[model samples]
Target: MRTTDFDYFLPEECIAQRPAKPRDSSRLLVFNRDDDHVEHRIFHQLPDYLNANDVLVLNETRVIPARLKAQKIPGGGRAEVLLLHRLGDMTWEVMVGGGGLKPGKKLQIINGPQAQIREDLGGPRRVIVFSEAITPMLDRLGEMPLPPYIHTPLEENSEYQTTFARHPGSAAAPTAGLHFTPNTIAAIEDKGVRIAKITLHVGLDTFVPVREDDPNKHPIHSEWCHVPLDVVQAIKTAKEAGGKVVAAGTTTVRALETAAHTSSHQNIPEFEGPTSLYILPGFDFRVVDAMLTNFHLPRSTLLMMVSAFASKEQILQLYKMATIEGYRFYSFGDAMLIL
Candidate 1:
């Protein structure tokens, strides 16, 4: 499919620059595929729509402060780097910005602290070797890498992360999880709905645009995910008890599905590794009965993945409804629950 096929008009003002005052105060657009129904609701009312016999699978991956400002060696030219992911012990992949800086050049974050560019693989990426541990260097200089479309500067650092964020590795937050507060989580549990957690450290690739006309032609970036056997057992038990496997975010869906794909039995084994699984339309879902996700960018792989899980035509119609209803869009925006 052409990238344009997924296009839609979004008012620039609808892009959320900051999160809603109270986290759960954000708007919620409920999409019920079972009956072809749509409802405009608030995020706090989410549990009211959900039954007790559901399992909410959430991604616990936390967003790290990855954006860094630096300077070129000797020339002292200004430069900025966004850490994508660690490649190895000393090598790291980064997205650099600012005017032309040739390959084999070195960038110093602070005076006398330089990272040598080992190679330039083209695009916004380069392989660099820092003077010391990549973590420590990032700890010293990195700022939170907010999405490009968000116009306002991030005033408070903590707002970029979810209230329940525990694992600090992802470049981006599993935004759907951001809507839930500790009280809301307890409310969901008080209703008898079970909660489970999985980890998929989201990378900068989550924001990479779909450049291919055919969605299948897009190469998905590999992300590390861990699905513990305990989560697998919880989900299996929930399913056995006639409960729905509801994923809190796309990352949770990916991790659970990847586990089911490689599981020896019907349950996922505890393991840690990388997954490049690109979930588009026509893909049979072995796990995940429903999804709770945020409004996605137009023509993004995220839109395609959800369209694949639900009905494409239904998603498109709902998106049009959302736009008409003046719903906020993108990360730090409102949410949709496809049930």
Candidate 2:
């Protein structure tokens, strides 16, 4: 489909600058694909829509402190480095901001190690070699790589992390999981809904828009993901019992579907490694039957994915309703549960 088909108007004021006071206190928009019915509800009431036989899949990828402040070694000019992926013990694929960050240029990370640009990957991206492994020093040297749209600083770094977050690798938070709290998780479990965790280390590419007029021609980047054997067994049991596979976010959906796609048999196998799966309209969804996700940006891949799950027209309509009804949008915004 044409990328322009996914475009919509989002008022600047509708964008949420910060998260809700209590995570579960955020709004949830429920949509039933079976009958095209819509309901407005609180995020904590999610269990009400789930069945005992359903398996809720969550992406447990944690957000890393990927943003770093640096200075040019000799000129002392300021620069910003955003870590996208680790290439080796002391090298990373990164996006740099500021001028003259060419290959061979050295940088001094503020209060951290020295780094040198080793290769150019076009545009703002560069391969950087650090004096030492920067992963160990991220806590002290890096800042939370919050989306550029979020102008206000977070009160606490934990606000950008999900309660289920365990593995540290993602450059961005899985916004859907950001709405869950301990109490919310307990409530869902109390309702007899079994929870399973998978991981898809989210990247800044998730926020990148499809520049191609034809979305099919867009070169979607691969992200490291893992669907463990236990998760596969959980899905098997849930499906065998006639329950739906409820994915917590698009990332989980990707991991599960990628696993299913890679399998030679009927059931999904344990899958690990980089997945370049791109879900568009007309994609055959073999794993995820339902999904809970946050509002996405206009023309963004996230929006396109949800549209593929539901429909382009219906998703746009719900987004408009949410906008008119004052539901927040973006990373710290409200959630949408499609069933």
Candidate 3:
């Protein structure tokens, strides 16, 4: 329950600097919970391990170009902004970084395409006033806010999002879904494994560390999610047929599990709304039977959630193995499928 319990040593070199040449070429560390076994294989080999009755639930939320750096007018001081979420009617919850642009300061952002600080709650989260709707401005001025660890420049912003990215709301990609290539998804369908999509607009909260030692004491951030009726029916049908429900990412897992809470059946409930469920050890997984996820940062809630899916010791052991074997880590890194 202590935050330190999830800690592990990871060499700096193991943090992936960039994506693999062919996206699906990255390694897959498959963990079978039923037998407590691990298999190392390429990601493209995913279809070979799945079958017709299985259901693959994926998060289809798209990553927007959220980072925008603009110079303050008149004096030309610089300010960095990462748009968190649009609060509609021309308001936005923006994480802006700069000095002097305090509360009530009316500043021109980037040469007449202006904005004003209506409020500054401090520490990166702010409420801003954009002269016009944010959509047009973001379409022109924003850049994808890649994870801080990936220092290289992204010539194409699309690479930061998955190939199947559709809804443009998530600040971050549901990374486990990142490993799947177009061919890989096609192959999965070819094997008769039904693929379903859900939406969980990932936020900075998913990456925030557990500040409390006891997992139950930590607060979680709410994220907007939607689980469609079809995906629900498919999961229900699959379970009835004695097939497993495999979640593609933690985002999808959270969405599906949240929905299942309302179901008359034990594991698959129908749901739609915002969820702040912080999954950790001792949490009963009512819906998901298997999970596909990316390597997470040390002591992160994500790592702890995965630990809950398997045992904390098993998850930590795999992390050590991943580090020693030089498997890439974090958003653009390798993936693991816990079956």
**Per-model TM-score versus the true fold:** 0.95, 0.99, 0.96
Least accurate 10 contiguous residues by lDDT in model 3: 104-113
Show model 2 residue runs off by greater than 4 Å: none
How would you encode candidate 3's per-residue C-alpha lDDT over 136-163 as one tens digit per residue? 6666778888887889887687778889
| Model 2 deviation from the true structure expressed as Cα RMSD, one decimal place | 0.8
The local lDDT score (0 to 100) that residue 161 gets in candidate 1 is: 87
Q: Which candidate would rank higher by lDDT, 1 or 3?
A: 3
Give a tens-digit lDDT track for model 1, residues 231-250. Answer: 98888888888888999989
Off by over 4 Å in 1: 137-140
For model 1 the TM-score comes to 0.95
Off by over 4 Å in 3: 263-267
Query: What are the RMSD figures for all models against the true structure?
Result: 1.7, 0.8, 1.5
Question: Candidate 3: global Cα-lDDT?
Answer: 0.85
Supply candidate 1's per-residue lDDT for 123: 87
Give residue 217's error in model 2 in angstroms: 1.1
Instruction: Please give the clash total of every predicted structure, in order.
Output: 0, 0, 2
Q: List the residue pairs that clash in candidate 3.
A: 260-269, 263-269
Supply candidate 1's per-residue lDDT for 319: 83
**Candidate 1 at 195: error in angstroms?**
1.5
